[model samples]
Target: MTAFTAWQVWGRFVVNDSPSWTEPASVLMMGWFILLGSAVGVREGYHLGFDILVVVLPETPRRVLVTISDIAVTGFGGAMAWYGYQLAAGTWNNVSPALKIPVGISYTPLIVGGVLIVLFSLERILRRLAGLPEPHLEADPADSVA
Candidate 1:
């Protein structure tokens, strides 16, 4: 939906300035940005507990901090998923902007993304508990795969 609208806007730009196309295009761009931000862990990295503080800590403190962080993130995800599901389901009757699409449909991403983060946090927590190496959010470009 967003991609199609973006294409439509691009086409409009190629032609002449049409308010109809521009309006939806702007809206689509905003939605796309929000979706992309929510889908990836990038946004989470910038939030509460994620930072360079852990990097300077001793190994024991670092491990403890990361474990605590994982638990907190998992809890956050659980709450978001639960409340988001309720919001989506309870507000299913509301109409959206643009195409009058159901507002609940827009909230589907919140549930999905929250669930995904929960899953990721669980895996990380398990890894920490098992004394395995921590997974970096981004792989080093020069690291060899084996």
Candidate 2:
């Protein structure tokens, strides 16, 4: 994607002949990157959240809240996957203006990433139920500065 952007910039400024395909291609690539990155964040328990409440809650309440949150995430991911499939299917016949590729291709990442989130969240929930240790996201204490 960076290569495409560089080529686009060089061609426009130096060669005076910018390629129309670069913009749309870069956008497609970025969309895939963001969707997949979000899935990875969920898998690693690195997604953004307000942890103050969870931290203050007692252990039992915290566990219940965590379980509820996980179930919600699982449901959301499932919905995304299902609706994304419908969206991709509906747009399969449509082509992009510049790239001329099927527009449905753009939605592929949503379906893939959503399914991955569902799997990862389900795994986390299972581990919690089985009394496995919860994954921690704390940074090393030594790494902190005064």
lDDT per model vs. reference: 0.66, 0.84
Model 1 residue runs over 4 Å out of place are 1-39, 42-50, 135-146
What is the lDDT, from 0 to 100, of the residue 133 in candidate 2?
76
The per-prediction tally of clashing pairs is 0, 0
Q: Worst lDDT window (10 residues) for model 2? A: 135-144
Q: Which stretches of candidate 2 lie over 4 Å from their true place?
A: 48-50, 137-146
lDDT of 1: 0.66
- The top-ranked prediction according to TM-score is 2
